[model samples]
Target: EETHPVIIAGFGHFGNTVGRFLRANGVNATYLDIDSDRVALLRRMGFKVYYGDASRHDLLRAAGAAHAKLLVIAIDNVEKRLEMIETAKKHFPNLHLYVRSRNRFDAYELLNAGMLHVYRESLDTSLRMGVDVLKMLGHDAYHATRMSKMFLKYDEKNLKKLAAIEDREAYILEARTRMEELERILQEDTNNRLMLQVDAAWDDASLIKEATQQATAQTE
Candidate 1:
């Protein structure tokens, strides 16, 4: 019964990534997965993984949950994720739980349940791709990055704030209002940038010359 500091409840993509990185850094973790085939394959490859239903307290205990300081819930199923959270909270109250949420709605539920580190699986990556899209569309890289950061900050704050509102009508109104406000701010930013570009001293020829010189310097 060797105990590990970290216990991962899922062995899918997200959980596997964490486990691989942790192992690369010499950190051993006990991994529990419902997929018996994956468990057998990983065990054959010299990885320590146990096949069990992680939502069960007995399975968690068998996976060294009592001694584990960190429990990562990377299960994809919403019901199972909630069940795992409830079970962990009840049995391993001392463990620091990190949960993977499918969206803002899932995050709201986790936040309301008192889990502090709930990660939205797609939000950050999607925002990063959006920032790159803005850059490719001729926006300044720094500006695009700043705008993306601001958007993420506001969205996260709103997710937490809106979670407390119980009335569905009020929630919809607040969400709609926030969306309009964000659109207005972005529109203003776009107009201001266009105005600045229009008023710049350098015309197309000078801008082209500057770019040509930079490219020539890089080549030389």
Candidate 2:
């Protein structure tokens, strides 16, 4: 068995990106996947992927779970992902877990299970799209970016609150209330021109400089 600093289960699209970024930064991770075809393909492509179910205790131990500092759960199946979390926690109590959640509902289960590092797979991408739409509608690039950041912060905070409610009807009602509150707060911010203020890190001068350079290049 080889020792790895990071053990990533599920070498699919989500896990692949995480593994790639870590590899690019000079970090080596042990990758595990249930899909034999994908595992073989990745091996041919130079990725060190082991074919096995990560939810299994034996496979985790073989992957150096006892010594690995972090375990990333990026599997697509919700039930299997939760099972992996349980197995890892029971066997390697000290290993940090980074989980990939399908959505807010999936996130609630992970949160309820006491997992701290949960990544909602599509939240960031969806927010990025919202920012792009704002920019396309002639909003300031910096302002749009700031709004997205604010929205993410608000949504994350609200997710935790909503996750605690067990009743479906109660959850739906609270979710609706939160959505309305978010809309009102954003409206208030717009009316107050809070988002219009320039951020020093992304000031208008830099944007103007970039635009001027583009225009200059076009005429040349």
Candidate 3:
């Protein structure tokens, strides 16, 4: 029987936050990090974590790699991330890896390897924080986080959906609808920063126009 469990590798900012967030939500997770100090700190903080490199077969196996469900590669190093991915996919064939990539190239590599859930770490959170700062001094941690998550889902869906159609006017119409939906959401959520709201409006309009033009040009 496979004892699948959420496994977080690399105890940097990304990994630490993931572990803490999961634990706060009452989800059990194990941490694998090469930093001895971080491992010790997390262990002292009562988290199930250990010091080790994830790219090594023995270390991953010891970390229950065979039965691990979700593997989060939160490390900053591009090389290390690839190594971990290769090892995990090769050894733990069933593991679903959620990788944090530095840029589009890294994302492409991960995607080429059949790793889907790749995140551009810090980009979303930083954007949300910037929006919050622009809106006002008021910060509601929970609401901000929730709104950010919603925004990401909406943005990702729109971006991917827009890429499929070859019609310029159709793409523009779809983008306009998305903007309207964003505005409606912004109005409904008091947590949204006013500056962000304004920025989103203009940004969405510009994006819609550009997409429409590009699609039109491509088809012609």
Candidate 3 wrongly placed segments (more than 4 Å): 1-4, 137-220
TM-score top scorer: 2
Query: How many clashes does each candidate structure show, in the order listed?
Result: 0, 0, 0
The global Cα lDDT (0 to 1) of model 2 is 0.92
For candidate 2, the TM-score is 0.85
Better of 1 and 2 by lDDT: 2
Q: Candidate 2 or 3, higher lDDT?
A: 2
lDDT of each: 0.89, 0.92, 0.77
lDDT of 2 at 84: 95
- Model 1 over residues 2-103: C-alpha lDDT tens digits? 999999988888899889999999999999999999999889978888898999999999888888899999988889988999999999998999999898
| RMSD in angstroms between candidate 1 and the native structure over all alpha carbons | 6.8
**Which segments of model 1 are wrong by more than 4 Å?**
44-46, 182-220
Which candidate tops lDDT? 2
**For all the candidates, what are their Cα RMSDs to the real structure?**
6.8, 8.7, 15.7
Worst 10 residues of 3 by lDDT: 156-165
Clashing pairs in 3: none
